[model samples]
Target: MIMAWWQILLLTCLAFWMIIDQITVGILCNYPLLIGFVAGIIMNDVKTGLVVGATLQLMVLGVGTYGGASMPDFMTGAIVGTAYAVMTGKGGDFAIGLAVPVGLLMVQLDVLARFLNVFLLHRVDHFIKLNDTKQAARNVVYGVFPWGLSRAIPVFIMLIVGEKFIRQVLAVTPQWLTTGLKVSGGILPIVGIAILLRYLPTKRFITFLIVGFIAAAYLKIPMLGVALLGFAMAIFYYQKTIKSSEDHESNSTVNNANGKEYENDKGEYEN
Candidate 1:
């Protein structure tokens, strides 16, 4: 697929907006799944976009940029991967292969963006002392440019490089390398899920977990059905737990009241 200038510009803009969205009005545009879906729509390949986004999203599950720490830029990976997957007509795994290095490389750019923003922060401080509120505010917005560009510039350049170049690179890539990518692509999500489970109270809800696994893996229940069942179970447990807590609190309150009454009555009789 020959990518038009408009498509490149649109995708670049989307990439630019995502980082700003992350720091400011976060509506989960920072998520790879949404990025991929939007990118796929731009490429006229929603399936590829969804597949790429979903795979990367799973891989990044339980991963965070907490406390200003940067994780791999999988969101960009989804955009590039979805675009190239559509353009190259390659498999989702091949797209994953293309995305892995790009995501890792973007990490350095992410750090660079933050480091550049430090200067803006300093300027904001200076303006605070000078009371030039407008310049400080402008600089604050200016700070978003580096962060946006860190993602946009690379995606724009890469997309403009065209499908011919991508096909050529794929032609030169070894079968073993591609195979490895497919395997790793599948494995990474499991690792992400494992990481997620580690932080969840899995032991307390082990039965639910076991049942879900059985329903999905053995019974081959549709994911939607499995999800609904899980929801029902969660609601049931939540209501039951609340009821028990309320009962315990009521009993405690009654016990305390009876004890106080007993003490008062005994003191009156002694008097």
Candidate 2:
């Protein structure tokens, strides 16, 4: 399949995303956009791809890195979701909405993949213990190849078989249910934000986040503008807080020394 011109290009990009997603561990791989855009190019439907990509982007806007853990298996969602969405003759909000649940379902499968990868590591370690370098290399290759195949095969199968099932499921699902999923899709980023909040030590940063939300909600400020303002505010707030702390420390030290010196002078005078 990779030999065909368009399929080759798509697979190359897919492979690139897979490699990068593993290396950066998903932090750097924006798979949704890549999948939608590349699939769009292959299918000659760039606008639909962009719309789907942008919509999915917003749906995941609140996702973040937490304690070295990624939000979910975005690559699976990207590849499978894009393929399914495009194949279903849907675009824009509908396609994006469809992709959201597909992405969510893939998370569990991703955990399974992680568990299997861990087992592979143990097997690799066993080879290393025997001083079998070639075996170790083979073990690593075998381990990594399955990980790639696990992702690629399921996605390929979904593209061929799962798309129709998804369409039927969506057809049967009530309007309200789909709408709820869309709403959840928009709000699910909060889970990521909450994960990020664990690292926040000061209330001031929380206040800024609230302010940004208010600006975007009430003031009708653009999201990008609000994000930029929030970033600037966070920087300034932390800098000022740090400076104030240093100044307070210096003042405390100076005052303590002055009190000790005054006590010594009084003792000298009394003596």
Q: What is the C-alpha lDDT of each candidate?
A: 0.90, 0.63
Residues 98-169 of candidate 1 have per-residue lDDT tens digits of 887889989999999999999999999999999999999999989989999999999999999999897787
Model 2 ranges with Cα > 4 A deviation: 1-20, 23-71, 85-89, 111-119, 161-184, 190-206
Please report the TM-score between candidate 2 and the true structure: 0.70
Q: What's the lDDT for residue 74 in model 1?
A: 89
Estimated TM-score for each candidate? 0.94, 0.70
Residue 248 shift from truth in candidate 1, angstroms? 0.7
Predicted candidate 2 versus true structure: per-residue lDDT over 89-146, tens digit per residue: 6445455555666666656655665677787789889989999889888877666654
As for candidate 2, its clashing pairs are: none
Question: Model 1 compared with the native: what TM-score?
Answer: 0.94
